[model samples]
Target: MNAEGTSTAGATPATVTTIAGSDSGGGAGIQADLHAFAAHGVHGTSVVTALTAQNTRGVTKAEPAGTAMVAAQLDAVLADFDVRAVKTGMLADLDTLALVAEQARKGRLPNLVVDPVMVTTSGDSLFEGDPKQYLHAFADSPTVITPNVIEAQQLSGTVIRDLADARHAAETIARSGPRAVLVKGGHLGPRSTSDLLYVDGRAFTFAAEHVDTANTHGTGCTLAAAIAANLALGLDLVQAIDHAKRYLTRALKAAAGQRLGSGPGPVLHSVPVHSAPEFATDA
Candidate 1:
């Protein structure tokens, strides 16, 4: 049982575990995940993989945590926590990725959501070396990978310039091992955003009009966390992702004028409309 008085044996209120870096800017990474988890009313725990000096402008410097430290953190959390879902983001190096994959392989994790964060919105590279090899190891771990357009291009070895290209890349990346793929179209040109979900040989497209705003930091982290939160709440992958998107849309709209940092700034993770107790009362 947990502090919330919920049992870990059966499906009830989902408890999500986030493995990612720390954002000093409080816009992305573990910060965003925790905020999203709270908004979705899921119990959230985290193991920090790295610490970053970043803001809305861009990531100034990132210091990767020792692999042993990363492993120890995971051990500490899993040793005593009943984590129903796990989401990973911003692993600075290959060793950390391998460690996380190893834990998953050993069945220490569940409902994994892999957000391959390679490049920042400012075009800064987050990984130091070839991450493809390490990322490929996650293909067979029964995880759901959410990669943006640029990440898909890098992972699939193809240029994704349009919707068709995005679909092709999603299919190709899906072949690598993830049970599902969600290719985000935020980088696509103009109009509306179209995020494609590929599962079991079928493609589902979720589209929304672009909300023109500069304070879009941590969008990926929030979306992946939201999905993980929903999974923790007993929703399937499709339902979880759909609810995540809707929640993100509202968050973006609510964060329109609020300025938090000198750079791009962070979105309002707590949107009033979606804060209804009934929707997220579990936590």
Candidate 2:
């Protein structure tokens, strides 16, 4: 990423870009991702894919940006910033997906994290095209894909009910191209929440005590953006995802009872997640 010490936008090059949609409510999508980046001390940039009239209650309407407009934004960001990592969320349609795939092919967005955003937390479909086709566009090595149970099932064409189901789905998704796959079970009916990490022909389980809170509006986007930020900080894939999960768990726990909206609230990112700050120096 243009040398570690290089300047981009007149800042040190720990910059990350989130190519996703905009939430008027500021709980998910570009807003949440930018907040996650700030937690890790990474500079955040966003290319809004769509705009939504949404709040903690639900999404009333979603409007996608034109292909030409999105392309212009992408061009301007890549030209000016030595972006180290990119996190993709709600890509509206195939054309926008194709534009992002093109940049990845050109080696512009190096450390890519794909959070195949097909549906909103309020149960609304965002992308109208073939889900499989949209997902396969991101099937490339040097990319990490985070798919929840439903999304994993859609990508794998399987029904996921247990850990075995998660394994099969993760493996099938891995075939699509990403070297790493995280099959999240946050939607499972049972008590605890567990995420299956599939990497290098193996699976690792990260189980967290479910906070049982409705303030989980932007959990997925937050996790993906945190991973991207850690990667920009020069962490390995496994390490980055591990740190991100830790941050997400604490963030979720911090916002359990606090209501930021009438409906589901957002994770309180303003709280410090790490016990010891990463860049702290001894005086």
TM-score of each: 0.90, 0.91
Q: Weakest 10 consecutive residues, lDDT, candidate 2? A: 274-283
**Number of the predicted model whose lDDT against the real structure is largest:** 2
Go through the candidates in order and give the clash count of each. 4, 0
For candidate 1, what is the TM-score?
0.90
Error of 2 at 42 (Å): 0.4
Which stretches in model 2 have alpha-carbon errors above 4 Å?
A: 1-13, 275-283
In candidate 2, what are the lDDT values of residues 112-215, reduced to their tens digit? 99898998757898887888975568767347889888888888999999878898888988887878888877876646477888888988777666787888
Encode model 1's per-residue lDDT on 1-283: one tens digit a residue: 3322223445454678999999998999999999988777667899998899988888888889979999999999889888999999988888888888888888888999999887898998877667576457696875689999888888888899887788888888888778788888888875547788888887877766577877889999999998888777776777677778878887888887887877777888887323221122100
Residue 99, candidate 1: how far off, in angstroms? 0.3
The positional error of residue 171 in candidate 1, measured at the CA in angstroms, is 0.7
